[model samples]
Target chain A: MAKIQIIVICTNLIFLAFIARLIIKAKLREEYAIVWLLITVLLALFSFWRKGLDVVSKLFGVYEPANFVFTGFIFFILIYLLHLSIVNSKLQKSITKLTQELALLKEQLKETNKSKIN
Target chain B: MATQLLIIIPCFNEEDSIVSLLNELNQMVVPNTFIITVAVINDCSNDNTSVIAEKFSVVVINLPVNLGIGGAMQTGYKYAWENNFDVAVQMDGDGQHPPAELNKLLQCWHNTQANVVIGSRFLVNQGFQSSLLRRWGISYFHWLNKFFTGIHIYDSTSGFRLFDRKAIELAVQYYPDEYPEPESIVFFAKSGLSIHETPVIMKERQGGKSSIRHFYQLYYIIKVSIAMFFSFIRK
Candidate 1:
């Protein structure tokens, strides 16, 4: 019982640290942080429930400290992918804006040149 | 003397300016402008740019894939080399570059008989209300050019210029794909080509937002700087 309690507190503390770091980094959006926070919390709970995780980890041949570390890596990668998606969206928007502005300018330039011709 | 100049106007999605740019080019008082071919490299524009360009007597190079500014230029340079012209001028198809002032660079080319005559907006510390970042980039590369290749080119990144056959040969033979504009100056100087500049008036790009993205702006500066440094070290 004491071992379980200690593991639970340690996992919660580590997960809480991740949440604090993400907030400070301010890269991932709030909505993304919510989903990530939920996942971390769930994983923390799962790690606290040792017997279930032990069985799952044994099944995956990650029965040692591997479960917590692997879960942490996956959670970080998910957050990173979310950040990247947002960046890609911004690039797309800028490219669209530029192309549209170019089209409009070409029209005005055409009119200017035409008037000068007469 | 119009000097039978072959002006290479590189266009991507410039359907908007193609016709009028052609009109302006036709009216220019350049002597014997024989084949003033505006090589429009259709960067796979989904628009009607190619159809519009075809209406004019301009040479159109349709790339199966978009190779960007450098690729478009190489295609045009290849066309210029194949056709056999005395001089080739690179004017922007975006309507930013004035067609009339092409004469200034051409004149510089003829007068100085330099291998490469650039239409420089930065030569006299004039032209373009550039961003602070861009200004810094220009200054850094100008210094790098002097430091690396012992060639001092003022406007290291201007796409507007005239290149004779000798300059074209080197560029066509070996030009970097990603950031070719700045790096090309280094290559031109390294090849012992007399690089000269002419003061020409330029304006804000009238249409389409510039292709340089905010995030990639630093990437561009870094990539070119590395290439310049590495190319220097290679020497």
Candidate 2:
């Protein structure tokens, strides 16, 4: 029981700190803050809810809540990391596409400028 | 004044709007004193996007395979970097980014000496029209960018922008395919480049539906937030 209470308090404090940091120091995008807030809340909920873990384990035919929660946390983190990797890949590619087009346009302009000067 | 400005337009199966966009660009009448180049990155487009771009005298780069926007743009950058250009602008092929207004961005960077100058529709009440849901998404992105990058971003996800030689060099080497705008901001910031925004009027696209993947925006927000939070401290 005490462990659950400590987890809950820690989670709330972490959330408070995050919010305060964003408001006071971080000039980050609001959309990004929403995403972080959601994730933090989700993590907090997962950390504290013993019944939720037990139910998830029972539903999945697992016997131990600790194992179930631990496994679930690891799985979720892995998926999220993969998701970030995919986004990073896509962002990089888009920049490349636009950079290429811009370079070509500038080249044509250069030729035109040279021709006119001559 | 003695710099070459290249504009890369990434199109994915854009047939209907490609022609109009090309015409607009050609009609813009860039000052003869300012050298300009326009390259269309066709990401293995299944449609006539390549044919249309080529016909307009714009250099068309057809990617051997679909690399999405990031992949297509990377191909463009590699070409630009290899060829040695002074500046690069990223323009969407969806007929939304006004080619005529591109000079505004160039001028902002030229005058202020900023490393990056992005066309910001939010700066002007141009009555930018989009689905309410999309508007919400854009707002969400704007917020997300501020949280992660520690920069007050006027346009968090806009692709219409100009980059200096330094930015182009960095982008070609490290940019990712998805979430290009937010992720690149972090890259530029981490590398200690000054980023700027210029207000521009963007017209609603006339054709070729946006191919944004389902749930990509949400997923991107979470991923980028974490990445930037960590990358900010580490790099």
Candidate 3:
């Protein structure tokens, strides 16, 4: 009923719809889109059940519900960023390996061609 | 059986020195039982480095993109691994690591059977010993490595190194990218490999700027320290 709750609900609905559009267009992978969708749906749930967050926060032994929400989101973001860095490291290793392999193969090809000419 | 020695010289824009370096390397004398091959990993230099290197009998690995010093050197190691080289030496492209004194490193390896024989400029305290500031930086890594790996490395950052097949195999498997010399020493020590230091003089870089520039000293120390710490903890 609160204006803030109504705004939160509307925003999450729009975000969910946007994510759906992205998935349908094949712009976002289902695994990655699931993370965004889960966040939006959880936010919507908290907005509708105003007392849910307070209860959850109390269960988590946090004095303030707002603090709990901010900390949770911070933790989630940190975990997501860590995931991204792991992905980036793997990508870098792959690229380095690929580049090295290609260069070596090219050298071998050149040697073969040289021997053939002889 | 003849020993295959690969001199891996990773270069970036060393157009001024590559020709002479290769010439000197070509003329260096090795034991009749050892067959030496020079492989230069051109890190996508925007100069004539690769062109000149190609003119020599040495193998030039022209990287499509610049992979910095660590990646470039690893490419050379990979080549050595692939070609079944018995020994690999990492020398500088800027002519700082002398080709004539290479015998000392190879002799040390043969005598002590160390997995790695590092050319330490400080062992005899001669040749281009680098700046006072760089010496202090080198000492910091030395102590840091001793603390983590329990191995005292005199010249931890020396690029002039000889790696036997075991060390070469490990390097080809996993090597740190950027500022790898000191970090790799720690890595080698932690991997239960024997390392020996021999006194070999190194000259001032003939041409091109040193990879660790004036401003990057602080970042270099920090990054290498972190890399060493990770190496210590890694399985």
Which predicted model would earn the best TM-score? 3
Candidate 3, B176: how far from true, in Å? 1.4
Q: What do the candidate models score in CA lDDT, each in turn?
A: 0.73, 0.76, 0.93
lDDT over C-alpha atoms for residue A116 of model 3: 100
Question: Residue by residue across A11-107, what tens digits does model 2's lDDT show?
Answer: 7777868776876676756755776777677667766774787787899999998898789779977987897899886786565555555645655
lDDT of 1 by residue, B7-120 (tens): 766667777777777788777766354446566666667678778887776655555455567766766676666657667888888876778888788678768999998888
Angstrom error at residue B50, model 2: 1.3
List residue ranges in candidate 2 displaced over 4 A.
A1-118, B230-234
Clashes of 1: 3
- For candidate 1, what is the DockQ-based docking class? incorrect
> Model 2, B1-235: lDDT tens per residue?
5678788888898898888888888788765766777888887789888777777777777765566776677667776787788888899888789888888897788789988898888888684656767677777767766776767776767888888888888877777665567677877877989899889888887787766656875676677667656656765
TM-score of each: 0.64, 0.66, 0.91
**Candidate 1 residue pairs that clash:** A102-B207, A102-B208, B2-B31
Could you tell me the lDDT of residue B121 within candidate 3?
94
**Fnat values, candidates in order:** 0.00, 0.09, 0.70
Model 3: what is its DockQ?
Answer: 0.71
Collision pairs in model 3: none
The list of candidate 1 runs beyond 4 A from truth reads A1-118, B1-3, B33-35, B125-127
Model 3 misplaced regions, further than 4 Å: A1-6, A61-63
At residue B2, candidate 1 shows an lDDT of 42
